[model samples]
Target: MKKMKALIVAAAALSLSALLLAGCGGAPANDKKAEDKAPAKEEKTTLVVGLDNAYPPYGFIGDDGNLTGFDIDLATEVAERNGWDLELEAIDWDAKDALLNQGTINCIWNGFTMEGREGKYAFSKPYMHNEQVVVVKADSGIDSLEGLAGKNVMTQVDSAALDVLEDEEGQKALADTFAGGAAQTIGDYNNAFMQLESGTVDAVACDLSIADYQMAAKPDMFVKLEPLSTENYAVGFAKDGDQAMVDAVNKTLKEMYDDGTIAELCEKWGEYGITIDNWVLVD
Candidate 1:
């Protein structure tokens, strides 16, 4: 009976050893299965671009009432390359600063000029250079910025034109000569041009790019006087002093310039010969 008990104990020990070996051999398989069934993860990327819905060629509402324009296309291309979802926001021109400051949007991607707005926001490297021109009827006999002197001139409120007219040493001298006869303030270039159309204003002082777009839109009715002032356009962000976004955009733009992408876009948009002078981080 003692011999039989010892044999049973040895059999039990052998069975336990076999069970331990099997468990150790299958451990890697369990781990591999868990790894294979792990949940898939999506990368986070979203760019919200803000713009005025009334500024055409740069940004405006299409016949479909959706925002579409050159700036919109440019921002969309950037987002696509960076694997980000693009959210084009139609915002009021007056609300741009507040919107950016409050983080309601990531950037003001409109045709935001760098003339008077410099130092007020974090700006991307200049992407395009443009001039301000006077728009008058074909028969208005206006041929120069000075021709608007003593005549009704129209520009948008808060526009570079207004600032230029107010500059102590700049074009303000020209407007100062006119003083009470200086350009009237309007809502936008559209309104300025409309005032010219209705003969309520003799001339309009605004950016050359918008004038070019207007010529493209209504070639027969309007003509440009001459380029008065020009400036580079930039992307504006909150004044957080962080330039990572501006730097990235500048780098991308440089790549675009090197690859002829900028040239192509300009030609496609009919803004050829308009190029950025320099791209550098200010802060």
Candidate 2:
């Protein structure tokens, strides 16, 4: 009888130990609940920036073969500040509109001109000033816009120069007088310069800063005429693009400018002669 009692007591002890083990397991359940209530990290949005990667000091492949430029740095900072990913896409400059319309890129963040392009896209505030200019061979004797009259003139396709050439108030008449039907448009500036080199074209109209860059590199090869028309540079989004994004970028850009980020970048690209230190956004 005593043995039987001992066995019962042993069984009772084992049952108690089992209950304790179950309670310990329940503590882990509470831990799991706590984990479930923790906040989840938000996913980042990628701001796919489209640009003509050949344009230097704005967006271009650097000596190290990585894409680097003034605009690139700003875009990266804006993306980081807004918790968005930065994506650089080198696109055909002429197809910038199509790319934006198709949502292939979020915005054109290169050296995009905003004067003639008003109402074409949702535009960010102008960040800098630019000018259209003519480039000719050193001995071409084209010292002014009038010198381009009746000459074979070419420019990059879809460039601000071409837009100016087409605008009635701009240089439309001058371009019409060129030997060709209109200003010959090439896919890139390199080819335009090549045409000028080969004497196939008498002159090339392009952005003043780009003309300066090319002239600086080949000092004895080319000469720039005085600016044809001055214009503002801004970021371009599709007409129906995300307004929220436009507002966000503009806010961030203002912050950067106030904090001197834009000034520092301008100084960094000072050799390119592009700066926005005194710029005031029209709206």
Candidate 3:
């Protein structure tokens, strides 16, 4: 009877030990299995670009009613190459500074000018050359800047052309000779051209590339005077915004230039005077 009790007790102890060992060992195995079944997810980034939707050859609404243009295509390519999703925000040209500073948009990528704005924003390296000019009716008999005297000349509000014309050391003296002693401001190029077509405005000061597009689209309707001022196009970020992003864009632009991608884009927008020969990426 004693031996039987001892044997039974030993058997129970062995069974309990086995269960304890199984519980401890099975828990770790199950945990490892669960860990092996799950994977860490990769996060994707979204790149938001700001532009003037009415600005053509850079960014504009197409015949299909979708946003399309050189800057749009270029931004799309940059986003794709960087494995990012792209979002284009059409903004009021005059409100760009506020939007950029307020974080409403990431960066201004449309035919954004770099000169006279260097101190206000962190800009990518100049990618393309640009010129500011005045467009008039082909037969308006206004061949020179001096001819703009006492005429109602106009420019897009908050534009580089406006900057040039308003500069005291630049064209301000010439603008002072106009009817208002300054250029009238409009909301957009489309409106500026509309006013020109209706003969409400004597001339429209604008970028050369945009002028070229307008001229090509409506041949003989308008002609541009000699360039008022020359400048360069660049991507603009808020002065306090991401410098890394600017560096990334600069690097990508150079890569594009080297790999013939920029040349192709230039060819696509060649009608607007965007040619690889004008691309400023060297070495």
Candidate 4:
């Protein structure tokens, strides 16, 4: 009987050891399986671009009621190159600064002018050229800057034209001739042209590209006056934005330019007078 009890005790001890070993050995495998089933870390890959969609050949609502333009196409390419998704935010032109400052938009990719706005925001390399010009009714009898004297003149709010009228020294003399005592600021070019067509305003000071588009779309209604001031277009970021982001955009733009993508897009928008022949990536 003593031998039998001792053998049974020994067998129990071995079984206990096996159970402990098995418990220890199985822990790591179970933990690895659990870890493998865990969800992956999600990364952000969406870029929100801000623009005055009312501005055509850059960004505008198409006849199909969809957003389409030169800037939109360029931005789509940039997003694709980075494996990111593009979200177009058609914003009020006058509120662009507010949008950027509040983090509502990632960047302004419209035909945004960079001259005279130094230190206001981080800028990408100038990618295109633009000129400010005045548009008047074909028979309004205003053919020159001098003809604008004592006439009701208007420009879109927060536009390069308004900036020139408000700040540039050489243009101040001409800006002072508006019939309203100062150049009136409209919400958008559409409104400015409406006021012009209705004879409420004598002329609309706007970008040369936009003027050309407007005139082409309504040939007999308006004609472009001589350019008021030449400027360059660049992407605008917040003043405190990440420089790395701007650098990334500049790099991509240069790549596009070198690969002839920029030229191709210019050709696509050539009817609107958009050109990139003078564009050399500003270092």
1-283 per-residue lDDT for model 4 (tens digits): 9999999999999999989988886887988998999999888567789998888878999999999999999899988887778889999877888999998997999989999997999999888888999999999988898899999899988889998887757488788877866799878888888899999989999998889888878899999888889999899999998787788788888888889898899888888777777565734
Work out the TM-score per prediction: 0.77, 0.83, 0.86, 0.84
Q: What's the TM for model 1? A: 0.77
Instruction: Supply candidate 4's per-residue lDDT for 251.
Output: 87
Kindly indicate the candidate among 3 and 4 with the higher lDDT: 3
Model 3 lDDT tens row, 1-283: 9999999999999999999998888788988999999998888777788999999889999999999999888888888888888899998888889999998888999999999999999999998889999999998999998899999999989999999999997899999999989999988899999999999999999998899899988988999999999999999999989887888888887888889899899899887666777678655
TM-score, structure 2 vs. true: 0.83
Best by lDDT: 3
- When summed lDDT is taken over every stretch of 10 residues in candidate 3, the lowest stretch is 274-283
Number of backbone collisions per candidate, in order? 0, 0, 0, 0
Residue-wise lDDT of candidate 1 within 118-218, one digit each (tens)? 77888887776767777888888777766777887788877777777778766777776563746688887887788788998887877777787777777
Tens digits of lDDT, candidate 2, 1-283: 9999999999999999989998888778988999999999888788999998887768888989999988899899999999898899999887888889999998999988999789899999887778899999999877887877789999988899998999899988888888875899888887788889999999998987788778877889999888879988888999998999999988998988888888788788877666665355524
lDDT comparing candidate 3 with the true structure: 0.90
**What ranking of all candidate models by lDDT puts the best one first?**
3, 4, 2, 1
Show where candidate 3 strays beyond 4 Å.
1-42
* Model 2 lDDT at residue 224: 88
Best TM-score among the predictions, by candidate number: 3
The TM-score ranking, best first, is 3, 4, 2, 1
Query: How far in Å is the alpha carbon of 221 misplaced in model 3?
Result: 1.2
Per-model root-mean-square deviation over C-alphas: 8.1, 4.8, 6.5, 6.3
